[model samples]
Target: MVSPMLSMNQATIKHADLRQTLDTLTQTGYHSVGLWREPVEAIGVPEAVRMVSDSGLCVSSMCRGGFFTMPEGPERRAAIDDNRRLIEETSAFGCTVLVLVVGGLPQGSKDLAEARSRVAEALAELEADALAAGVTLAIEPLHPMYCTDRACVSTLDEALDIAAPFNPKAVGVVVDTFHVFWDPNVLRSIARAGREGRIAAYQVCDYRTPLEADPLLSRHYPGEGVIDFKALTQAVAATGWHGDIECEIFNRAVWDTPFDEVSRHVADAFDKYVAPYWPAE
Candidate 1:
């Protein structure tokens, strides 16, 4: 089997001109992308689709659409419906997965368990629509720090449990290095993801020290920090996976840099850190 290719998450270079961002990726030799929702809306999906397709870049996954942990009512329904639309948009782009962040606290609420329940309820409602659209919803477990405001599902174990009821091919987990590296159970969780056939997407970024001084600046490029990425890569590949190894970074400093340079830097770092682990026959 061929090695998994590198993919650029648009948010990493989101500060750049949209068209130029796509062009920069193509010029830097990346053929896959992971896009955030805001830019798609800003540029209009039809035109964005055209830009990606014309440039010969495949969208590996759409960045978001799953903040269902908020207060229930029209707002919650709207979130679910919006996800359905996102799935339709994913279908239009011929992308496979819609990355679900699962959401955090709602308004004045601070109950983590309640927030998680909302995510479960939302998934139960949205799964069928995703299956119909042939779009997989990859539940991304954000780090524990993000638990209060980003995602209640902050570990691979919890993510897998939530995804257990659905068809693995339809609803799955997005293994992001930044989030799972801190989990002592990550290796076992990854093995379980492979065993249960639920590893929908796999990404890697290095971890920072101090872990809290600057939250946004915590993520490092592959091989730049303490993550045992080689082991993580092996665990992911043990699943017999053949897909893009997406680079999903969310560093404020990195974002401030020119978008084109960030794209090239991501591609180069991926090549240096994860490329060698691809099976060599």
Candidate 2:
């Protein structure tokens, strides 16, 4: 059974030092954290690993990998090699999954379908490396608004379709409420993921305000938003998913605040807005 835990994704506390964030999170009773490569590399991977270990914090997942849609050439090959390094780092930190954000359209290219295919090819190459490392590679389907620049895998179904070739190993989908709550087929997708053993992670957050055409700006705390979180949780629970339910909010307003306060707010919001739905059954 996967114990319910929290990870301090870089989204919440942007300006604070990574070590300080980990320390504070540990002090606050969060047993796990998400390590961002940018900050981790800055601090040195070995030292970063040691710091997390010394603090007794488990890393739930590494920040990112798999942006193959850019220059499908030498640049893309370099990304694959870099992802191998990320897998090694995740292993060192005792993380369960290496999160992947499949890239979007290339510069001046409106060919989204081609970008999606590029991601599929890249994942096929990375799948073996990830499985060999005993680490799952979780493809997070970003909100549709980010389709142009973030991730072409913009839905759970799409991700599962791409992950079809890597079953029973570690290629899977990440269900983030903010990205998927509005999806017409979310319930079926979650159940399908469960059936296929492809739920690498499930993230819970809400979209409070009515969405603008821009999907990036549409995110809210679990209950404060319009997401039918009850239905979402019911679907996830139905699949017997005991994995970490991450709270990944990328709100600009939240990131600009104090770290301590954001943690408190996020934790409180989890309890008040998100946790009630995931009752232990």
Candidate 3:
């Protein structure tokens, strides 16, 4: 079987400098790298562009540009403006998709329905700009656990619903195993996303059992946890997804490991757990 093209999300080596990260990715044979906004902004957009361009690596996607659940006021306005800028940045990086973690409930509010409504509204506001920038806004549904604070859109079905009214070229959904694996409807939702032509990105990471104190950092490398990568990968492949499959881990241990070591481990994990399911050449 042919292996899917592999990309490493920057969060997997959050501590590594851009040059070092790109060097390791190229040396390790990664086809692409997922750039994060924080690090890109830190180095300045022009420098970041030149570094990635010089590395001769494709950008899988940019992380991220959403947080629109705030009530209408300065905060919400600022988020919209920031997202417009992110769209520009994503274009500058030569990346086609911009991942969006639509914000959770607004401060002091418990209404999930209302919070989600705000996300849809915000997407509508940003759709024109995204289209103009030629960047697809890929809404990433975080795990339900983060619905209260990180992202209210916690399921692929929900993300699709939000993207339905917009042009698929301008908006779509992100399929991340760590967040959606636990959902019973994930397979169907993935298929729906594929049928609708809204599968913008597929991010791979394992879910470690026995939740950590801060569940945000609980993601593990593909084969180290309870997730059935083979099954999940096959499901995603069934959608005929042709984009990069990014390995995005958030474990503290992984963060502490050397970038080269992490790169080797990730490549091994992808081969062992995911590559076999890819379509045969």
Clash count list over all predictions: 0, 2, 0
> Residue by residue across 1-281, what tens digits does model 3's lDDT show?
11348899999999987888899998887779999988888889999999999998999999998998989999899999999999999999879999999988887999999998998898899999989889999999999999999999999999999899999999999999999998999999999999999999999989877977889999999988888777778888998888899999998899999999999999898888878787765
- Which pairs clash in model 3? none
Candidate 1 lDDT by residue in tens digits, 147-252: 8877989999999998898888778999998889879999999999989988888887889787646685678778778888888888888778778888877777
- Candidate 2 lDDT, tens digit per residue, 14-114? 66677778866766777677777888889899998888888887777788887878766788889888988988988888787888888888899999888
Q: Provide the TM-score for each candidate, comma-separated.
A: 0.94, 0.92, 0.97
**Top lDDT: which candidate number?**
3
Q: Where does model 1 exceed 4 Å of error?
A: 1-4, 211-214
Q: Which candidate is the best by TM-score?
A: 3
Worst 10 residues of 3 by lDDT: 1-10
Determine the backbone clash count of candidate 2. Answer: 2
Better of 2 and 3 by TM-score: 3
What is model 2's C-alpha RMSD? 2.6
